[model samples]
Target chain A: MENKSIEQLNDICSQVRRDCLRMVHGVQSGHPGAALGLTEYFVALFFKEMTHNNQFQMDGKGEDLFFLSNGHVSALWYAVLARSGYFGVEELGTFRKINTRLQGHPATEEGLPGIRIASGSLGQGLSVALGAAQVKKLNGDDKLVYAVMGDGEQQEGQVWEAAMYAAHYKIDNVIAAIDYNGQQIDGPTEKVMDLKNLKAKWEAFGWEVIDIKKGNDMEAVLAGLAQAKGLTGKGKPVLILLYTEMGYGVDFMVGTHKWHGIAPSDAELANALGQLKETLGDY
Target chain B: MEKTLDLKFTYTEKKDTRSGFGDGLLEAGRQNPNVVGLCADLIGSLKMGAFQKEFPERFFQVGIAEANMIGLAAGMTIGGKIPFTGTFANFSTGRVYDQIRQSVAYSGKNVKICASHAGLTLGEDGATHQILEDVGMMKMLPHMTVINPCDYNQTKAATLALVNHEGPAYLRFGRPSWPIFTPKDQEFVIGKAWKMIEGTDVTIFATGHLVWEAVVAEAMLREEGISAEVINIHTIKPLDEEAILASVAKTGCAVSAEEHQINGGLGDSIAQTLIRNNPAPLEYVGVMDSFGESGTPTQLLEKYGLNAENIVKAAKKAIARKMSY
Candidate 1:
């Protein structure tokens, strides 16, 4: 699975988007908007960027750890983890249901391989990642820690708390990214809580910020994540505010706050499935 | 049992339980390399300076951010590090209840939430800093072990005991210097009840600072010709039901005392236990549905009816209720 071409990662991203849609469609519930938006980033992370093991260990001592702070996109992460051999891809069928390891939010208690923390509650991932990064430093495990957050989650006070902590402690081993989709549950993040000049905000918080113009583009995501990786260990945490649509790949669901957490109906599902070509067979 | 009662109870000094937590934490750090301390800008208040001084690299000063401190502690546990987060009881619970619930307890992270300056005895800082509802808040969370250790030695013992116990635990201690009783080198158990005094007229259940009050109440009750069974209920969540029921069965009545709100403190746990298993007469000695204010520890205890005199009054009421029944 190493040395993958950009085209190959893009193909994986298409299949991931399809899996995310199908999982949500099967349940008739789950967040498909952010799941679709984060498809390319997840593909790039699981396939190329992170140095993680498919056989997940709770104490991720020597591996590069990834925490999904914006956990509404569990379907996408489940797809990515499964496709990357963390578990069978078939388990994606149990995305949100009773007696299933794949909960509505990501949890480690159910013996889920990739998930180390239960994160549906927003704005806690960065702090968790910072703590893990500190442990990595203490253990002298030069491996990096990665965290992905939602733009709307910035409104949570704890995020700023963590931001201040990372910078003040000079915890440089962590590389954080945000899906700047500009939409949240109630409405657009700007209308709900304007995070005006998000880049400047991160900069003011003492983080070395990277702005990705096209977060949904596989090549751009890969390059941005790679650049984020390179920026580590320079005495400051790195944050990549990657610009992405509310929903990508599927035409009708794209660029709107309405689809943020809504599952597609049969007709809508058909339209979505048609646009997202299944490169890998569906679970 | 008779031999236990024969032993003379005395203390040479009175010390703050927070200092015991500091000493115990320093010892824990020395004993285990995995022990890590995090303070939310209240290092001196929590008495965590020694642990920070000795293990400077392992200590994290989270600087007035209690929520982030809890989140970071939860995260550190993923790497097999036993994180001890130190803060005032108010900030540790009420301020960061959601964070502790989601990150530590719900996630089943092995983090010890060490809280100092609990209850009305937090002194002149007043109602804002003092948290009377932390016991209820923490105990309600699944996988959260609630402990309110009495006095200095018991607090130290509870601190050391939590390191060996797995899962998320809340250790509540205090700011003001109180009488140091319990044996300095005694073994501390997590869920087991410490029967401080044995009797049959009535049962007196207490925790934290109020345990000393209950002991005082015990002597007062004996002087009044009523033998009171005094039990130190340090572990609040895993309420020693067997010990409680056994004591209540022998006494036929109970009096619960704590330096917290009456609605959701050690008294409530005891009532719940007795009501379920053995229906008995009970009296509560705590703050009666009101907030605390700026006062000295002694003034606050007396004003709030959380002192030895109050416990003695509650015991007599419980005893009278039992006779009426």
Candidate 2:
């Protein structure tokens, strides 16, 4: 697929937001908050940022790879992967359904084309990405590996372990993004467990931190991702502190943690869909 | 009656199974460039020094983070590299079970999880380090091949075989210096039982460090005018059901011995096979639902009923029960 302009990517983002809401609404049991929150990041990544192959292979040898560490937002990833030609866009209808490739969390068991690892269990994706990046370095592939994790996932100790490992090994060929949505399932992350000064924490762990103040904005997301890509192949892993809303495009679900995992009702779905534009055709 | 036993097995050298893993990893790396080794701060203990020295670029020292090592190994599989992670059995299975389940087993990644210091034979570390439930934990996971080779030669062979097996696997070994009796040139076929001694009275099925105990028990039973068959069951998950049923059909009773818990080890697997296929009197020789303490390997084996004397007693009990039936 050809690289799209910011205006075109924004149009796709709106469509992806609609797809995320409907996919969650269809099942009446999927995470919509993070999915809606990271729509622009997903759009910027698949549409304008990363250089990848649509023809998927398990061993993504020469092409850049992405791992969805916070797999709750799988609705958004499924939408992006389908729209980006990994699979038919119609498969979005199978989200969270029985015998569907799009599991509640992203999985590779059903041979999902774009999914490299199963990750609903948080704080593991970074290590996996680092491992893949090391392999690429060993094979002289020169391709970068990317990963995304939720702000709440930072509380996991394995995440810190991976953080220390990346810096200690000088694994510089990978980029990681934190979906800094303050709200989690139980409430605000600050109240849940304060991630005091997350930027300083990552920087102290030897990461080149890049904060995208407006992670929901398409231009900001694209620029931040591009900068992260540029920072790769240096001495330390790059991190993007992406500040996104819990539910960016929706009105009622925007600020609270209520929409984190709960699905929208028929009436609520209509209201959420009313907020997001049907830029491209829905599945 | 004709002579029932003509040949006796003997070992001239003793080595820890961990050394076999280290040698096998070096050999596997030499054979396949895609084979990579990852250790979580147990390089010398796991005997991975040779592999690290040989393939410094391919070797990864992931500090003491077993979970990260597991995830790294799983990720390494995405690039067509066969990664073998080394750690203690406790850290390899219990500490990082969810990591293995979500990243490797559920994803169906081809990562070899090689664990040493398994079972009570991990002596002196006590219960914290000894993981008797690893085989059961690994075998329960879908797409995981559980292997517990008996000796140095067999461990080496199993490691080499896993290089081509192409899926998630758990290779469990121990730290004790054990007798190396299996032939050095023997082919280690996963899921196939090796019949160490053939008899008609009782079948003694064993795995890991207990196989040598079963061999000694076979000799001890032979001295008592009792012909006992001894079989080495290496791969516990894809068990050689045919060999087991065939041996039990001829022997009429069975005895299971291992350096693991009685609840979820080789004995449990064998008991399930028998109750479902061939109902017969079976006696178990393993650690009863209990944790091990700090002791020498020999002392721990004797106290935990994991030695040849216990195996012989269990064989007699099983034979007596079969006779009464």
Candidate 3:
């Protein structure tokens, strides 16, 4: 329950980014682009923001719930979960391997800590978070539920339906963040589905919307999250559109959908490791 | 004579399965504060108005979005709440399939997906609403317990039972009322076969609305000197293989009837079980490979060969196969 300082949070983010890149490299399979990209946010949730224990109970009683809607970025969540004491730090090496709880996607059946629902399939976590928020209110627990979805995943009709439900039910205990990386697997989000006027759309659906630079800045993310937490129990829900690079920390992996689900070659791993500091040591 | 069939009352103010679901929800709510009801713009159609009206705090009216309803139900299960989500079978299964796959079934959540308007009996709504493959779709999920109760009382009892059962479930029923034959006191247990009429020749594995039809066909078969046994196979997934094998061990032949497609429904499950264990002479009495059309419930039943006559014919044929085997 100890909230980390900005420096400590940044150090954890550095280690998480290293583990994420290694997890993808070790498997010779995974999506390192978004995983390395969302390190700050995931680290923020585990080390600083959310009120959750490391016991790994699927249904954490009286605790906050966080759902990874864009489940491909599981490396970010998995690494953060490992360092935050959900599981042994050494278990990060087993990610995406045979018979490991750290699956390519976050699955509750695996009994992994910090994961509530299976969300590999896009466009579902918002509704799930809303439901948890509602249950929290019913239990009078006053705990908040949070979810993150991809910008491209916003094209799903169900996302809007969940959005409307959150606003209509006045689900202020829930906060939804969009990973506005601007790129999906095929291409840029704008080219794929064109989420033109994203702010107006969230506003139209009765959400208190905010745009944040989510890839690098911890202070900005903390401020946005603080704003979100402060707006809880209000009439309207909050949606923070986080502008992040597809592959934020990694240099070579940046600027293309080619890194969406590719594993780095041995040579590529060397280059990536050289760029990223081994702050927490390799798993 | 088919054994998996039963019926008695015919036309006394037949109530929709949704009404039974609603009544059972209200009762469950009274008994357990953890029992919760969720609806997706079909609070009235799913007959959850009573629960919604009485326990407004526990009732979640998630408007017009089936995907979100399933997701929310999955999430509610985290806090040890027994959530029963109400919607049409089509909306519950096909519309939000991925959502159920991830949040409910794969996650192993203790949520009840109580779906109404299951088969062709949905009527007038046509092919769009008549989800004949719902059973198959639901049964395919890993941790999902699939059940299709025969009538109003049965659906109600099953709904109440699902609250106590741990893990995810799909309880499917129909929009219209048929035979309300089972005793109101009959205990509803998942994966247990109910023997309506004891017979010796053939076993009829029936579920949902067709359980009543199998009962009627038992009478018809008796008129022709064939002793048909009717057994209700309410729980399709985690099939009651023990009961089916027991009935088939006695009868040596079987007929399966349902208001669903022949592919991957109760019949498919029974066939798989029989082939592995009993391997009895079997004939299917459900729909062949066709979509439903716009018509009354009776008309659709007759047109799609889902009536008592079809069950009778299938039973006779199964007995004949048994004799030859």
Candidate 4:
């Protein structure tokens, strides 16, 4: 990726937030809270941080890979993938539509570019990422495999299974990020299913845990990812607990569980879109 | 003019079909270095210890996490590695079906889900470990190939065959020491049926452990002044429609025997095929809507009506129905 200033990255994040709102509103059935919360992280990853090829290779050999384990945030990933030149920018309108590659959750079935696995069901992405990372190490690729999971998805027992597997196998090439927005579909994660001492949990699982206190801030996310990458190859896997506000950009949708899966109405969409600028021009 | 099938079939020894899978897996690993094995803490039980010992680096002990094992196998396919996941049929399919559906089958990853201890023949493990519905569950997936080899030799051949076949496949074998009747060098085809006997009266289609039972039923039917055609349906999915239709067209009636549940196992697949292509009188010889209990393999087979006597009864019933029609 070409060098982009922090202001330019922030402008891309604003555009991604806009894309998330319009895409979800168009379908009236997509996860918007996660898409909005992970906007800065996706932009920071696809635009400024990750060493990925936008040409959309499915195998992703000799290049860094990113897997969205919490696949409900397809709108955010689709926007970033398109913005990074993986596909046409206009294809964002087909999100969750019939016969479209942009499925409700990320998938490889529709031959979607930049996705290696089908991850809609929670707690499967980390295991897949570890597999890819192991293959990379075996092939001597030396590149990293990156992944992101929802903080609420930690309730799934398979996620811990993968965490233990990665640590036990010494899979030192993966940096797993979590969207710690504290909000899930029904209510807050703690009120629903408490994730008591998440950082301590990761540490106990034998991972080098990094906490990004301001995940919405583009600079902090970029640096936190860098810090996670820095911790790789030291005989352990890396985990980043990225603290972000659900629907960070939209004022009405911010910091609540109600906006997790519901799309904004016409009036609400107008209000939400009004807050997010069309910095990179609407897709 | 017809080619009369006359061949002597005998087994000098009895071996569990899972051992065939282990030997076949070792051969597959030798033929291709990219072939890898992963087990969920049942290496000894699943007969995967040989491959693990031969290729320790390629062998991954997933440690009781069937879901993770499936996902990891799916991921390994991206780097051109053919991963074979070993576990009990129940844990392999029912426990981690969603993982297989999403990661491996739906994604079209080239993963071999080699399952052992299938059906009621798993014996004293009872209804909990004996997975009679796995063949049905795996066959329903969009891009999954399901194979249930009848004997030890065929299980080994099928295991070796899946490495060359693309896409995800499910290979189901059992725990009991079955007869080693099939030739060791027999070519294992994916969707082709093996015609074991030729007859004009009724067609006996059997899979898994029940194939040998069908062979015995054929001899018994011959003594009753009725000819029986025994067809070994190893691959349940892709149902071998051509072979099935051709045989049923000749016999006019059919009997399906499997070591699985009658509701959704090989019987259901055969019935669906006949109902659409050629409607024929069909009788099922399998577990009839009930879970099994702790018993010896032979005790369970005899109690559940999964022996040659049951197949002969079903064959007679199918013939009677055909005469009524």
Candidate 5:
């Protein structure tokens, strides 16, 4: 797809929100809160930001690669991957179904078109992205590697291990984003486990940090991603601290961690669909 | 009478199996440009120095982070680079099992997890570093190929052979210098057991450091006129059932030996095979559900009953049980 205008990207974002709600509601088992909040970021990435091929190849040679570290938001990833022409958009109906490639977490086991690694166990994707980025450097491929993780996932020690490694090695060909929604399964990240000074933490670990103040806004996300892209290949990995609401599109779902993993009831689904416009038509 | 292969063997040198891995890795890097090496601050311990020196661009020194090293190795496989991650067996498996399960095995990334200093043979580092359950842990994961080669020659050959195996694999070797009896130019085929001696009384299935011990047991049994079949079961996961069953069909009883715990090591795999296919009398020679301690490799092996004397005793007991049955 061509570089979509901000209006087109926002339209895709709304459709993705609709897809995330319905997919979670259809299965009665999926993470909708983070998925809904991350819709705009995914839209900006697949539609307007990444230099990628919709015709997916596992190796992803000569093209940008994205790894979903916080794979609970797989509903958002699947929606955008389908809209960007990776596979049939109708396959969204098979989310979490038996024998479907759309697993509860993003996995490469079933040969999911856009997925290169299995992630859900948390705090592993950053290391993987750095590895892919290192491979890109080795192959003389100028393309970049991208990854997104949950703010709550920063508690994992392996994440810091990877953080230290990326900086210590001066791996500069990757851009990583954290879905800084400040909410997790139980409650707010602060009450659960405070991620104090996250930007300072990344900066301390030697990453160039960029904070998108309005991550839910499509234009802000696109510009933030572009800025992150420009910061790459300059001797340090770049991180975009995307500040999105946990459940941005729906009013009732917003401002609470209750929808983090639970599927919506019929009434709640209807409410969510009402808030998200049927812009590109629902899958 | 079962046809017995020549038992006479000779070795001119003794070397640590980790060196075999290092040499084979350098050769592999030379042969395939796609081969890359990643170490978790164990360059000298894992003998990955030559590879790092020759291919500095491809060698990744990922500090002391084994978890990130495993993930990085898995990620490197995306662009068709075959990554060989070097670390101690304990850190290689138990310390980062979730990473291996999710990023490497379940995701089906072609990664060579080259683990050295496995089992009680790690010696003096005590129980914390010596991991006896790595084979069991790795083999239980679906799509994982587990290989525990016996000596320097076999370990080196296994390292080179893994470059073409095309999937996730755990290459388990040890630190102590061992008898290099296996052919210097031997072809290492995964899952194919090498029958060193064929006999009718009993079969001894051995792997890693215990393979040489089983060879010595064969010689001891020869003096007692108790003909024994000694098979080096290098590849433990794809358990070489054909060779196992065929040998046991002739011998009627079996003995399993390894430098690991008896509960989940080679003995368990052999016993499972026997009970399912050909029920036979079997005995185990391994660490008996206990932790290792600070000691020399010889003391540790002897204390753990992972020696020729133990194999001989286990073999005789297995034969006696077969007669009683």
Candidate 6:
């Protein structure tokens, strides 16, 4: 975290956003809103802040552990895996297909690189991530675990249970991120179930709450990640409430829940693709 | 992951089926460093108090939250730890069915769902605690393997066997202490049925607490000149079809019994087996479509028509049915 520069991480974040957009367009299905918004935090962890081996095996013994709780944004995850050299970027086309190793959701069924659990059902990932982190601590691994949860997903009661458990255990080896995009499938999260004072809630649960403005701003996100890493193992769990715009890059998909589960038709995909440059080759 | 057991068991003492599960949990946790256990505040009832004491770090007391406990276990499976969840039979399957289906079954994670206090043998807890529909609910899941062990030694053996097997499994047992028949060293295979007695008139297939009941019925039928064959159908989902077919083909009549509702238990498993492989006249002896009341295990068995006499009556009735055919 100390050695990596913000500019390098910001460039990687741009590539990650491009990858997220192209993969969603290629599959014609996926959630782009939160994926684009949380690009910096994930990019910061993998590309700059965290220590991990890109060529992943089934077990992550000494390496850093990460769980994608909100698995609907699997297009972003698959692209990150490919770019991070866990697998080939060429396989991104096979995403959401019948025989593809990349299913519509994240899976470990095919030993897909970088995926430990299959998570399509929301509210289960946080607990699973905590369990993995607990295992790492038991095995005396000093490496950290990072998990991302959607702001809307916070409405689930299990999330609070996990939050209480982590803080009570002083699970400093783990860090959780919330994609506060202000929108879910139904509408704005405020209208659905207000998460007002959400960061304060985490604080009350004995967590060191960190706030990040402009989730897509790679530099600020990288700095926030560094601060988070510095706070590790301090006898408290840390939460980063990342402020982001839904469907960040694609103009038409932005500021709405319309693209949450809807796949782009040929026409919609072409329109979305027009906004994003092919930084990495298309699948 | 399947460790071949070297301990040769020669059962000299009777043990309850719930204690068998408790024994296997302690042994499995000792053997595998990755094995962890969870209970929804049923440490004393499920006889998991010993396991909890031995490995406090590996054990989780998830309060009374069965739904949250299931979700935690589902999440724990992701990080490559084998999570065994425990609760009452009714709460484990029905109360948190969606959690099991979406989290464990559909996700295809390796989880051992150990359910106790099953069937009418749950006694004074009445219909509330006794879960007769668990076997049916568990078998309905595509990836789930349902097992109902006969006695204490067999339950311990089945729990050990599930540690090596991958995928979601439902292991059910009762609260009361029943007959601990069968050899102690018998290997509990998932889908293999053990032939307890040989006969020529009718095949009696039984599971759970009723296995001992069926064995008793066999001895009683012998005095009446009816040679009733008995088969212990332990693993209900991956049912031992080979033995069932061979036994019923020779006997020409079958009677299935269990401490459960007649609609979806060992009776249904046996009937389906005979229907496809060997069409035989079958009569079932179990709770005849009603909820159980507060009574002793023996009294409940008699009240619900699950006793040895009912099985004997069903066997004689099946013989009459076979004669008509």
Per-residue lDDT value at B73 in model 2? 94
lDDT of 5 by residue, B1-325 (tens): 1114334565778999999999999999999999999999999999999999999999999999999999999999989999999999999999999999999999999999999999998899999999988988999999999999999999999999999999999999999988899888689999899998878899999999999888888888887899999999999988899999999999999999988888888899999999999999999998898889999998988888888888999999999999999
Task: Write the residue-wise lDDT of candidate 6 on B1-325 in tens digits.
Answer: 0012111112346667999999988998888877889898899888898889999998888777676677678766655778889999999999878778767787687889999999999899888888888888888887899999989889999988988888899999989987677777679889899887888999999989888877778878877788989888899988888898888889999999988888887789788878877788999887778888899988899888988788999999999999998
Query: Which residue runs of candidate 1 sit more than 4 Å off their true CA positions?
Result: B1-8
lDDT of 3 at A151: 88
Candidate 3 residue runs with Cα over 4 Å from true position: B1-13
User: Which interface RMSD does candidate 6 score?
Assistant: 2.5
What lDDT score is found at residue B249 in candidate 4?
A: 97
lDDT of 4 by residue, B221-288 (tens): 77778899999999999889899999999999999999988988889999999999899999999999
Instruction: Single out the weakest 10-residue window by summed lDDT for candidate 6 chain A.
Output: A1-10
Model 1, residue pairs in steric clash:
none
Question: Which of 3 and 4 is the better model by TM-score?
Answer: 4
Best by DockQ: 2
After superposition, the stretches of candidate 2 with alpha carbons farther than 4 Å from their true spots are B1-7
Residue B78, candidate 6: C-alpha displacement in angstroms: 5.5
Model 1 residue B19 lDDT score: 93
Could you list the iRMS of every candidate? Answer: 0.8, 0.5, 1.0, 0.9, 0.5, 2.5
Q: Against the true structure, what is model 3's DockQ? A: 0.81
Task: Report iRMS (Å) of candidate 1.
Answer: 0.8
Candidate 5 docks with a DockQ of 0.90
Better of 3 and 4 by lDDT: 4
CA-based DockQ, model 2? 0.91
Better of 4 and 5 by DockQ: 5
DockQ of each: 0.82, 0.91, 0.81, 0.78, 0.90, 0.31
Where is model 5 chain A poorest over a 10-residue stretch in terms of lDDT? A1-10
lDDT of 2: 0.91
Q: Model 5: C-alpha RMSD to truth?
A: 2.4
